[model samples]
Target chain A: MSTPDDTQFEAAFADLAHAAELMVDPVDSAVIHGRVRRRRTTRGALAAGLAALLVAAPAVWWLQESNGDENDPPPAEETTATATPDPTTADESAAEPEGGPDGQASEDVEDPVLPAFGDLVGAELELPEFQPDGGSLNDACPSGPATLADGTPEWEDGQWYMHEGPVWVLKVVHTKLEEGGPTRAVALIGCMPVETMVRQAVVVAGDGAGGWEVTEEVALGDTSDFPLFDIAPAATAGVLLMVTDTETTGMYEPVPVDYRIMRYRTGSDLEDVTGEAYLLGVTDIEASVEVTEGEDGTWRIELTLTNAGDHEAVGFQMTACGSDSFVLEEFDLPPCTADSEGVAVYEGLAAGESVVEEWTFTPPPSQEWSGDEDSGMYLLGDVRPTTYSAEVFVYDPDLSNNGFRVDVTPEDVA
Target chain B: MTPTRGTRHPPAAEQPLLLRPTLEFDDFYAANVRTITGQIFAYTGDRAEAEDLVAEAFCRALARWHKVQDYENPTAWVRRVAWNLATSHLRRRTVAQRFLKRQQEVHEPPPDGDRVDLMRALAGIGERHRKAVILRYMAGLTVAEIAHQEGVPEATVRSWLARGKAALAGRLAVHDEMEER
Candidate 1:
């Protein structure tokens, strides 16, 4: 036989079901086909672009080194070709710190003839307000005919077309969870010209300690694909590092070479308070506790228990351990079952799930407990091996202050 | 017109090639194009983006038409494609839209008095609960069908329905109280 509460609950659910029924319809079938087709095209394009990069990288490097002589010939170039050993020829030169056969430099390489603008071109566009809030990029321009001073550029439209490729920015947001645990961070990266094909790599560091590092690269074909990527759990504390390469091109060389890197991080410390609760499992049983008033005219703890896995718990039993100093204001539980311990449990709690319970207490007359002394600390014990895991709270009857304690003993299960 | 040895006499005049319908290609395009487009548009709430998504879906479908046509519910097949496409689009365009416009608006307030309250409760519910409510009430799907579609145990679906209903009632009560204030 069901109680009045069960009946009321069923009625409420029926009403909700009726409401949901009013909002149904069949979606247009044609539109579905079109969307699928478009997605396929974009993915195909991106794949092709990556494939091209893989194929062309080595070839481009080879071409660059071979062409370097047109600009600067080696000191031994005047020597007879046959007399010079092959090992000491282009191969040895390629291994030099000043860039070898491939024209890629080993750290100390310096260009003898620097361009007028110091190899840096392009002006800094005003960054978007929503750009990543962490990590700053280290800027280097090897072919600067254009120069930027004080974050602005001198020429607007020569080699740099107005808004041609992605303008990149990076920032980190961090979130801390639990004390002494590594904080989770979300790296934010913003790229502009939203239409240019681009790829980016981001690294996150936690409190200068080692943490998980990931790199995500996205090649977008159009502006519609901006806000290209996101990292979750926006960090509360961490350093975010980002490197971005955009494709740029010149008349004789490949247009759309990879360009620019910007990085910055939120300097604030992140504190996160997120946790998980598990139900563990349930059993059919009953339990109880007691409550009494304290000397400070507030309700004092009689007994408390917490449900810690291993068994299912159904109800609780509370007995007055001291003088009746507290009055029961109300009990809370949906689909509630009766219990003697001033504790109740709802049905259908599965294993590995948890819910928070809150109780308010009022202090009795003549008992004034200091509120400052007892905040956030609760007296709760474990009631295990039964249907419910029992955790109890006790407070002053006047809502002034109270202590909480838990009692979980193997012998207490009944 | 001369008749061939093993064939019947052809038409006196030959028809222009352009005028001749390309049955295979046209049928393929018609059956696949619009359905995917519509599904994507519904999911994204943007006409231009929907167009792009649809185009991509069709391109992929065309590449694998032989395999796709063999599926039981081709329309459903296309819808899944569109759904995936729309999700990826949303992922890339996270900050572009101020808010995700829902695929469909709530046409009428729920049968219960507190429409807004019910919606808030619905929002708080998990994806399964919301889906259950949508399927059972709005889509008129049977519990068994919902189980099949969601790949969940029937009991799980029933539980979601029950929980969703109960939550809605509590929310409505709260709403009523607020209105009284």
Candidate 2:
């Protein structure tokens, strides 16, 4: 057998990468933004000067509020209430009339009981038209090929082993299209073996006479990759089926990425209403420079750095390039220098933070001075105007605002 | 180096909150979240966990945007933070216990067999090798970029990539044989 080349290896890795990309669920930026805001609020509260006083005041109220709010029952979608509560009566078959005004009681009166969602669906489950001809659900999931292509009977014991796990009925949700309308019962029912699990949704509607019938059976075909298992009532109407993809790499952590938001109305098929998820977070540092002429025949160079984005700019090494030229012109300020040790000279800038530095330099006074000399100061033979530009270099993510330059001309000098 | 003397202005929070800028952070977050999350997901094999880790890293970045924004590559910093968080979280969780619990509960749809095999192989490899492969292929980072971010020599990154590929191939080949049989 020939060995795979580098190109093949690269292609295979790239393919895996692409598949992983496709497998990821959309990220809700708003959710992340909320988390950040909450963290910041907590942090700010901690940093407040009156933190102890504030905490003392809120602690009492929070404890009382927490008792009620924290213990509140979970939302309706997670509840086991399979059928909608009727406003007027219980079951017509079992419910008894009220006692007479004479305070006499009826002995035969008994409240009605609702049937379990699983029992109702399981007793009426029939393979939808979309499913291939197979054994009844009571037989459990169909066990495929008893052997392998190599006639190995042990193949049945391999990864594809299909156990005869019982038919499983998942969550049942009760919702209605409009107020006072008949409540709809939506649930996910399926047969789970070891590997291949079949999923189907049975939607039943109340006839308002305590009678219920399966109005629509949705055939959710082979969900071996991304399973649409959980069912909940949609915010507006119908039912919402959530797809959860499990990550079985090294650990068995189940990652729930509300991957798809599918809506199934009474008569309509499953519709994809997935909203777009995008990224939201960036760094921006604004830089500006000012050059002004002083009455003392000197040029002033000012550089200002500001953190204009929501994030704080940290450990940025600010370099005022072209400062060495100013050093040759008898500048009152020392040359802006960065050490070889890579220290962050400017430190950091928080959101809406700014810093300013200024330097003043005097040009050559006479034309009799030598152009080249042993001294560090430059000697000019003429008063011809010279332009010195200063620029800032920062590690800002947004390069457009990272650097700022300002030109200072000696022509303005007297 | 000591910070140069400069006139410091009040923080933006002191001014009207509306005057603070946010568009840049939003744009940056929107641009890199998907790719970064995907890369982390490839490494961890859990998309939801990866997203949470990435979001956390970005949150830290925002908190210190003044400092992080000045880094040579802010995205790289975010990725490293996320990878570190993933490692720590994985270590904190009891994998064996979770596996047992998952087995008893209603089994979720396992990822594609090949994908599962690939992830299993990745898990068997060295941590550095797995990170290198994921960042290189999934994040589409160049060898030099990976080396710089990983704080290693480019040659070392190349070696890790080669060994990672060989390990994956060997494991996948065994899987294929078993499947074929």
Candidate 3:
């Protein structure tokens, strides 16, 4: 005996199937084929071009010098040779400024003295205006990958190479900053290869308190193949820029150039405290609550703590608050010796940090109780002397308790 | 193309030279291009992005022709690529849309049928549910096939199908009521 709902569902499913058939056509397939061919040719051309550049660097330099007048003196090849090594090192060093060598500000010394694009003056560098070339690369290309249709390299002769690539320019206007505060509405423009999409662009504002809050997340790009041209708030000073290559070719493998940023602000300048506190690193924090039915049919509560922090948080304590109706069930902490409170504190947590702490508890058996119903409700309190923010909720079912919270308190900072 | 009839079994010890088949660009486009475009169009509700995604999907497929050709359904393979490309596009678009003063026009309801509305509703019901609906109803795939593709248990796929159908019905009913009003 099928219910009316079942019959209706079957009908809708059939209708949907029919509609899909209508949508699919041979013409669509042809378009896909053409796109694939173009992409293959572009990649092959790009690879070949890169190889040419590697081989032709000295030859090109010689050609330019030979064509020049004798008075020019060919601009000392020694300086050029010495200059190249430092910038490569400097760029690599700047890539991880927070954890860079000797804990010194590399940008201060290198930006002013660098041979190419000398001086780190923000005002001197002009923002490229928004323009659509209509499949022409005549204008100065943005710093990122060239969206030009032709395989012409965008970076040419120390200037942005322009080509008919997938590039969209967004106008950022109406900029305002809060009085006496670090500039808000600061505009941040990020450029990457069209292959990499900007995932999340956040401007972290220093909370008057000792924490950082993401004030805004700049919008991603419109075209998947084309990288984002502009991100905001266009006027915020000292913004942390981020771009994510969302190509999921190999799900397990990390995307090359997966995370890159020109972070303007640091914890020292933005943090409320005067003393030095480095941003050791960041890791995804995860906390969950488990509910299990007891022999008596009562639901029990079990709290599990996982150290998802990038650095080992010494003497870390996670306190969770939940309804008193359920008692703490069995608790176990892996990779760390269990304490009296069922807390597991590891010596250190590396990248891809994970800790599974489970608490099993029986809820009060009674008026139609299901463990899954109330499983998601748990309170997470703030982590004291906060090194990281804690996310407390059930991700499996995407449910949150109105009052449940988790607080993390740091102890004995060296 | 007709298959050649022969009693030709290559010797076990002989390393067979894999013939890199020439892909007919026209045939490939005819089979997959629009589905890729449509997937992006549906995901982003943007024509420009849909076109870009279609182009990129084909580009990627072209780059990995040997692997793509080996798949049972190359169209499905390209469609998945387009879907992923569309997702990235939307992620970037969300950022662009946030700062833009004026929003682009929402996709209009199709005049001929409620299919567009159904698709819109499917889009609203989260990616997991949308995938379930798309794979089962749109692709005409069975529950087990969907489970295998999604890497979930058959029971879970069944649950998603049930929940998705209910959610769609509820949304449609509300939409109809709004129209009536």
Candidate 4:
């Protein structure tokens, strides 16, 4: 009789690997070979053309230099979309308060009440003991740009390799597991002004070695509005609160720079919320909705909005994104008078006050959307996605809000 | 993450210089495609995804074949790309899962086949240890080669192997016992 031992572990793994080998078809290089060949030919031609262009570029530049008009329209640069005029984009008379690299709230009001940073975060949220000393590209962060203990080049190199362009490690908050065996830290990151206005929430996991490993990074928003950003940890075990006074731009129409705060949970779920919740320094706007089937065979979607802040709610706009099985389409909103921007505006709600609104989704709505029948890319394994989402963009100077959605489910009336 | 482990990745500008595929690359692909696919398949229990990721990694290598062939082990370059693809694929899946859940958390087909016994056993160990085992057993890389590829110490590779095998042996025995009963 024979017994399995250390060698048997390799043998056992080898057997299962052999079994797994059969599960996948041998990767065919023919398609890849042809694709590479075509790309190479295209590249060679492009290089030759670029060489010719490069040779003639100096003459073109010389001619343009001599013929330069002092006031030729600058390149079609993207003008900031913030409703409140930014000092960077405004004339001297329209100058706003100084904005930090992290995009803190810029005060323009004669006596705008600005809350202190310490008051922004929750009582339970604790700042890290070893905070990064500096907030510039050249500054060394004592607790960040996590290096792996394994001594990999990325670990050994002091560069914050995960970020592009000049970046600042604004905040690094961690929760250590028993005697600091391993620590999980969330670093608030901001790129130089040249980069996009995207602030990042980077989660660094401490490897057993002295160094830290960057496990996750999520881009929260643009800097122009999040001028005053606050973070709340321990609010959710796997969730991190990214409270910033930002706007949901890319809406084409310009809305005021209302604070659009969101919750960033650490787990793998894409982002847990859309523009559905807000918790700013002094402004906390909570929204709840009820979905029910009506006697007329239509779906009733009722929305209740509440102000949990010290200030009164001045303006709030509601926009809905509807999708047929596989895509989000412009919502077929209920019959209601629209503002000049064509959005449904709810104005005037006092602090600690709640207001209710309702909308109805009629019957005869198609739940299934079709796609390529042959490949079945549309199928979420025998089912198709048929849901709708509604997001509210708040228009308060100090606060912002988000919205939620409803879907046809067995438990809920479809 | 894995791609940056080796000597700096051949720069993006170098791809155009390799205007044509050499017979050397064809020979290299012929020798290694099967083994790399098997390794990735074991790494990810999904057959279709393994094939797709492995193919994508090769496609990248083929584009940079001129410089890639010059690397100490071009196969390792493909492996790194495959591994990165796996991480990115998982991240994208997580996003899609959330979207689908919000859309309608209804019927989703269970994965097609039973995952390999080795994957279940490997799950009990840490990620780095599991990768070491797969690199050793499935990719047939030597301990020194894995150490170089991962940019870890040779002793670290050996330790990972010892711990991984020890953990795997017990998991496999328990799995076998349960299957028998």
Candidate 5:
């Protein structure tokens, strides 16, 4: 009752079961399954791009499934002979947060005078040079929960974007060892905010035998554990650590000193790779300033603000602070009180929206003698040392990337 | 959210039908993913590609499990979708390879043994015949199901299956003879 076709088909089916055994085991399949499930939940940046944009659910699955080993463009892992057209635009898997040729342009729309989110210029800050082969991230992803609790040098920074969706692998600097050993990848991950800091570093290197070897992890200043931001790799031996010294004890204006240091051992020195600034986080607000002096020695300070991030920037405040000399000499205004007459606040903006506001103050009555007080310009050698500099602050709970000095007129205003 | 092991099932009206399929789908996934993956692997010739296609097929099924579960054979649905994913992947890769070959000398990754033999045999049998054989053996699709998917007569499908299998058997016999020598 068995035809040649029937028996052969049975044999082939059995052979296929054997082949399946050769390919992916139950654990491997579960890993793939978990990844798909995780991707559905943690698609921070992927949710906006082509993956989420596709109308067909199957297309998204196709793109996700096709993502092959790290190093080659996913979707186009192109192992399938029929050539599944990768739905991912920009040449790889859903163009996530970093490293794209067109990255700066997106960040450059620059929201209104918002605080400088510390030159987080962006992950795409380093490209073409870094994404060698464009396929590593597909494999470089962490296998389990992305947590900094262990600080284990695990490849995957198992954190979700804002803990909402999409595993945000925010910053990864991929470099090979000196003599071309295994490729080394150091990524700055932001998942859960412990004390408002979601920064952690996980280093992974090639095992020289095709698998990845996670090497090191340094975060929040390991010792102080102050939430670190603007983390990027130092040229050679180690990484560049930048943190807004938030815990700088009481009193005195929080002179937001941007601390960026090369964190490495003595024998090994950090080198400069890219001159471009790679920020760990992104800020929604952008600030710009223009100063115009009126006929009566009065000056009109104009400020503008814009919101370019996905979230709404609420309670926008632009505060102008100054040293004693500049406060009294440059603006004839009352002695600079903290945020009194020195601050301009506005209702926040939704993404892509902008707002403008202005404040006017007259020059100091006595210092107008120009020829006498070191060019009468606030302070000279200590030139603008006493001059009022305006800083914009959006009510970010973290306030880490939310404070920046706005440029005022008279010096380098043009 | 999925109900835990001991959790009581809510009354029919209170529970959404969509949410109810999780357990069923899990069972189905556990039962079929391995089989479907092997089937896809044999058809695609690359383990990673096959795995990807299988996962993609399952992902699509998960999205529409409510309807898929209603079908007489949900696994067949996954197989069909997975086949599309694999073929599309292959079609894309072929174009890239052709383009690369035009510009420079391109080397292909070595195909595995049984898969290579199967691929060559399928090619010898011709596209339509090969599709029927694959749907029958690799995807576990019955002749009528292949006929339905291919929009052909059942007799035509059976004929393709017969010819494709004969071609495969001939090729394997030759391979076996060579190996023995």
Candidate 6:
């Protein structure tokens, strides 16, 4: 029988597996959720700032043009009309020349005005009843405004309020997803206290009579962090690319982690089509440890860090620590003190490759270290034990399984 | 590793937004975090490190929950991420030491003597063999599942298991001898 007697291995592994079950502390998922939200909020704020810059640039240019020409007509008397041209008027303007019917600048052929933020956020429209899950809104906590007058949303007595006046509209896009389709309004609505609030992506379609009604809504969970300032039409028809801040932001330019694909049809609701095309660049690297005794009665520690992935892995740093003061509480790898050092890899590790690092160290003259030596303890001086660890820096996409550790005791020495 | 294809995920537009399930993330995290964390703990041998790695993995999963939920096995994906995190954490000293440095005082007790011995023995084996053994015995994954997870053939997994068991048995035997001495 090629199978070695596994009775003892089974028992030991079983013990380890059982012990692992006990190691888990009750995690407060809310803390993690909060962290995710905070990161998202930070990214969103950054995006919004950039968007403000873009918007301000055009305004700055217009101001310069007006300042340069004293004869330029005064800014058209502030109008109640929004940036969204009335469909009927837009058709009329398109049918006519650039100038008026009377050969003067016509009111119908005016430049598009920027919509007031107040108008976009304060428009009278019906929002879909939002439930956290598929449950009814009635089951959700009571929602109210921060106060009756201010109407700022607040949480009171475990109930959340959305004050009557304005909901935070993160983005408002007037482009239609489908070609030759009605230009519908898409609003990304965020709740107050953006970091903790779960929000919705709402699609509003204009009623034949001119009012807008929420046609569809998607409840983006607390963890979803969409970029606030950017929404672009995808090259493909009926598709909208909604940027998210899930990936690392570049130093100079904001790099979106990925886009959420929203596809819409003339008669259908907006749908999230972000499917299996969302692929992550992942590589697996396995680390193994070995210990051998030298003829000089010193222990030779050998660590084999292998690139187990099929492709070359690049841009990783390594750090190693060796110490006799190996108390569980004091176990650490930084401050490289006299006992540790960090290594960096300049080149990439090819597939199926291995990097071997070895360290030879002598134990103290006396070996009276006592304990369960088999329990990952190694003797250094009188009773102090030695522990060692080596690790590679985490890479993008997948940040796990990149390091190795070893603990040595005097018994391993010759 | 490519997970086996299962039921095709229905398009989000197919169902009305209100009717579509929105509690998937909450339920998925609650259902799998402990198990995935435990598996990573067994792999990393350090409880605090395992917890941190698993938490990071789950956070990444949450960042892409909308897309991840449509996967064939979301839990398996989370577990793979956590396991890879643990593996990567184990190989690099600075990052791991940095992570360990920030750890609060560990409230959980250390593993018993037997568990420590097992971890030590695991450290001495071939990486693939060790992973196969853990995935099989500790994770309760069948040989075929280990094969799929490892992107190896089933027979290769069986071979690793046998060799892993033999190597582990030998290491434990040595430990037993040392105890007797």
Q: Estimate the lDDT of model 5.
A: 0.42
How well is each residue in A136-219 modelled by candidate 5, as lDDT tens digits? 431332224332211111101111123322224444443322321222345555433222324455564433322233455444
Worst 10 residues of 2 chain B by lDDT: B94-103
lDDT of 6 by residue, A1-414 (tens): 133445655666667776777767635565445444443543443433332332222222222111221112222221112233335344333443232111122222211121212223334555543344444431241223211011211111111223223344434444334443333345555443323333455566544332345675533433345442223222222324333445222111222134454544555675665451111112344556676766776666676667675444542335444343333221233322353233323234556887776656555433533434434344221000001111111122222444455565444432
TM-score of each: 0.30, 0.34, 0.37, 0.39, 0.34, 0.37
**Best-fitting candidate, scored by TM-score:** 4
Question: lDDT scores for all predictions?
Answer: 0.32, 0.45, 0.36, 0.43, 0.42, 0.46
Candidate 1 per-residue lDDT, tens place, A202-286, comes to: 3333221111223222222222323122222212112222121323211112222221212222333322111111111222222
For residues B15-130, what per-residue lDDT tens digits would candidate 5 score against the true structure? Answer: 56765677677778888887776666556555555665576667656655556776666766666667655654543343233222322432323246665565556545443456
Worst 10 residues of 6 chain B by lDDT: B93-102
Worst lDDT 10-window in candidate 4 chain B: B102-111
Model 5's DockQ?
Answer: 0.08
DockQ, cand. 6: 0.14
What is model 6's native contact fraction? Answer: 0.38
- What is the per-residue lDDT of model 3 for residues A269-368, given as tens digits with 9 covering 90 to 100? 3212111211222233345555554566444444444445443322232433343333454422111112112122222343345445555544343333
Interface RMSD (Å) of model 5? 18.9
Quote the lDDT for B114 in model 6: 72
DockQ, computed on Cα atoms, for candidate 2: 0.07
Q: Note the B-chain TM-score for every model.
A: 0.46, 0.73, 0.70, 0.70, 0.71, 0.76
Which candidate model has the greater lDDT, 1 or 6?
6
Worst 10 residues of 5 chain A by lDDT: A381-390
Model 4 Cα shift for residue B136 (angstroms): 2.2
> What ordering of candidates by DockQ runs from best to worst?
4, 6, 3, 5, 2, 1
Report the C-alpha lDDT of model 2 over A1-414, residue by residue, as the tens digit: 233566775666677767766666544555445444544443342222122222122112211111221122222222223222223223421232232222111111100111224223223333343245653642444323111011101110111112334444433444443322334455455555445455566665433332344566644645555565445444444555545453111111123122454666666766764441110111355667777777777767666777776544432433333333444242222233422111113334556878776656665543322343213332111000000000011123343454555443333322
> Model 2 segments beyond 4 Å from truth?
A1-4, A44-414, B1-21, B94-116
Please, what are the lDDT tens digits per residue for candidate 4 over residues A1-414? 123464665666667666665555654456566544443443443333332232222212211111112111211121121223424334432322233221111112111111111111111112221223444522432223322222110111111113333343434443221121122345554443333324455565423221234465544444554432433332222223443445222222233344434545444453433243332222345566777776876666666777766544433444443333323122333221221112233434567887776666643333332232222211010000000000011233322234455555422323
Score chain B of candidate 1 by TM-score.
Answer: 0.46
